[model samples]
Target: MIEIDELLQQEAWRFWDQSLSGKSKSALESFAADDLLCHLVGQGQSPATVRTWVHDQTVVLGIQDHRLPFVDDAQDFLRTQGFTPIVRNSGGLAVVLDAGVLNISIVLSELVQPIDISAGYEVMLEFVRLLLPEAEGKIEAYEIVGSYCPGSYDLSIDGKKFAGISQRRLRKGIAVQIYLCIDGSGSERAELIRQFYDIGVQGEDTKFTYPDIKPEVMASINELLGTSFTIQDIVIRIQQLLQHLTPKVISQSITEDEVALYQFYMQRVLDRNKKMLEK
Candidate 1:
């Protein structure tokens, strides 16, 4: 596993906090933003970046999710539950994203040899561990069976998962993304996905096995740590952690050039999503 310091020892870091951008930003734009950052960072046009985002009532689905026999109906179910559904251009199954869920992405350049897939995951896992020092040994990275988007790098305490990490690579840059269940009921979020799969699969066999989604095996950090930490609190913690790790933490949004690039990426994502859902 790569140490936290090793991954964050850059001379400076760029930080983007878009958690309160309101509903207009949408989760699709967030993924496109990460792709833009990945390209810039990979080409050495930008420093390593840490971005935080939150979208109201959004459910990000994996590519495999679109292949479900009744995916359109499953999406309709999510809409009835007040959730906007979009297929993310990354790995992992469907995951809920609300104001209570804090999403973070660490964009790094693979300038040398390609970064090991596990190494990308370890970077986010170690960063989360650093963010919540109080959790200490309680935080473990392993596949939490029955959890939504369950993966080998699922961040959990005692057995219930609170976060899952996924990676998106572009132009030799890697965007390691994680959604931390900062506040609210993680089980409730899992239950939402549980229903999605139930309606999606309807007892039919799938080439890719979706999680059984035992809601009890999932929890928010607040619930697991017995603390009342909010999204803003965790955002502050991320800033402070970055400050301590690097000499300078630059706060900025994408540049004008990046805005153009972001538009191109956004259109690509929009097109892909429309195609997937329309199928």
Candidate 2:
């Protein structure tokens, strides 16, 4: 069995792609052996294979959105805005992204201990904290009431949510992914989610408790830090953490096998999107 140390010691593969490619997800899923852990920095999924490239003009909807009363109208709205609307299988509600947002993923194989959920979350939390240690104790994990995609694991500082984490597992492979609003106005994104819910829900009371979505509750790490936080800065921080940790890290390209796994994952994504559209 490959030890966790050996797994963490390996430098994470950073793929910079402008297009949403199956190869990226394949690398995270099939490329890794059963014991090797996987992480997708910006993919927004655990065991989530693809590092879905959400461009600036993209509007990502959550699964619950299919039931929306004005679904077609919402789709038309998206088209009018030149936003490519797509459905993501993860749990969060609608979230917008562009060049300013930083997405991360951590891939790890499920081990005997059963990778800790909080541990995985904290790993990303700690990863971000390492970037700006001054906010070490300040980075908090709690549902920021009224924030879009509000969850118990929302990462924030001084009451503003800046990042959210989710996990997915495929076979023995696990991928932990997160998106950080590093430079843009975080509240604006929150407001965007608020609008999505407003349109999707159409004021109907449903069993699902959608986030109240207070736009003011979220902000970018840069704004919260009083310094401009750039994706480039975060990229360096991730590399640094791997170097500083006890696990010796080695960065490498995805192998052929992982590519095969991603193909299946991509098919699932495509199928899911198709079913959602049919609804």
Candidate 3:
């Protein structure tokens, strides 16, 4: 396990917006930025970065989701609900993204030592633990069986899930990502995925067993914590946490080089998603 003490020793950079509104960066752009930064960090050109992002009314689907029997219907249903459907390159099933949801990505380089899957997940878990100190023993990592994007690293309180963690590795760099449901109703979000899978699969018998989603199994952080924590509040908490961990936590901005690299990664993801959706 990589300890927090060891993580603090590395160079850290923070890239986040203090306000939650008007974030125009698409989900694809955010993923590309992570990949670009990963390569930069792997080459020792940039420090480890903690980035926060949010997208409005989008449902990010996994590759398996594109394989659904009635995927076209699912995408149409999502569109009818005023949500844009996007096929993500990373791992995970369908997940909702909106202003109420905040995503955090911890991009690190494994130049010195390799980061195993468990260790990569632990890093994100530890950061979440630090951010929500109030939920000390309540925050547990286990698969919420009925929730959308159910995974072994699902961050939940009691039996209701509020966040899910996923990782993407490239060029000796890793991005441990988590989407925290800060406000709004998590069950409502789950209901969206439930409806999506319900329509997408149409009860067809396939090799993949789509989750029989129970919206009640999901809750937002504010609901679980019994406090009104906004997207900005958590973002500030994360910034403070990173600043406390390192002496020189700087705010990072996109560079021309990163922009060029981002174009490459973005096109790759776009092409992959295009191919998957076309199937």
Candidate 4:
């Protein structure tokens, strides 16, 4: 687990993307920011940053996800369904991203203490618990079979997964990220991926085992709790939690250095994505 007591006491910055208009912002930009933030923190030029981002009608596929036997058919299906499919330069299965799904990335410097994979996951788990106090003891972090993007650190309530955590490290800095399905139906989201796999795999035996997705195994927080929770409500909760955690939560924008680096990383991501699609 992350040394929470140690982490909260440190100076931190926050970046909340005001992309309520949805399609105005690019999901690839978020990936680039994670790369840039990691470098800045690793170099001691910036403090840890917590960034909130959201993308609409996008399905981010892992490298493994792109390896599906009939991947072209999967891509075509997604496109026809009005979903922009992009291959993420990270490790994870297919995950749905949209305006209702809030993504939080905790970018931390590893200068003082090395953050192992498990510790990184735990930090995000702790943050989720902080955001939803009502879910304190009920939320469990474990793989939920039949859920899209199932993993050991899948965050669930009862038996339905509402979130999943992943990490990326660069230059001694670590970015632990989680996607919270705060609003929309999580089962509906899972069904989309299930269809993608059904079209992509066509019963072919792949070395990597694609999930036998069962949409019933996933649901949004609102659905799980039988309450109407909006993304804005959760954003406000995040701000409150950050204010309580730090002496001052400095709102930041992209610096010149970060902007330049973002352009570089964005190009790399695009190139890799194009290569994957071409394959």
Q: Each model's number of backbone clashes?
A: 0, 33, 0, 0
**lDDT of each prediction vs. the true structure?**
0.90, 0.62, 0.85, 0.85
Off by over 4 Å in 1: 1-4
**Residue 65 C-alpha lDDT in model 2:** 68
- Candidate 4: the clashing residue pairs are none
Candidate 3 clashes between residue pairs 3 or more apart in a chain or in different chains: none
lDDT of 2 by residue, 68-134 (tens): 7776777777667656677766566776666667666666555334566766666566656766786
RMSD of model 2, in Å?
A: 5.7
Query: Could you tell me the TM-score of candidate 1?
Result: 0.96
On TM-score, the stronger of 1 and 2 is: 1
Clash pairs of candidate 1? none
Worst 10 residues of 1 by lDDT: 1-10
Q: Largest lDDT belongs to which candidate? A: 1
> What is candidate 3's lDDT per residue for 14-62, written digit by digit as tens?
5645235335656877778778778877767788888888898999999
Give residue 141's error in model 2 in angstroms.
0.6
Cα deviation at 75, candidate 4, in Å, is 1.2
Best of the two (2, 4) by lDDT: 4
> How much RMSD separates candidate 1 from the native structure?
1.5
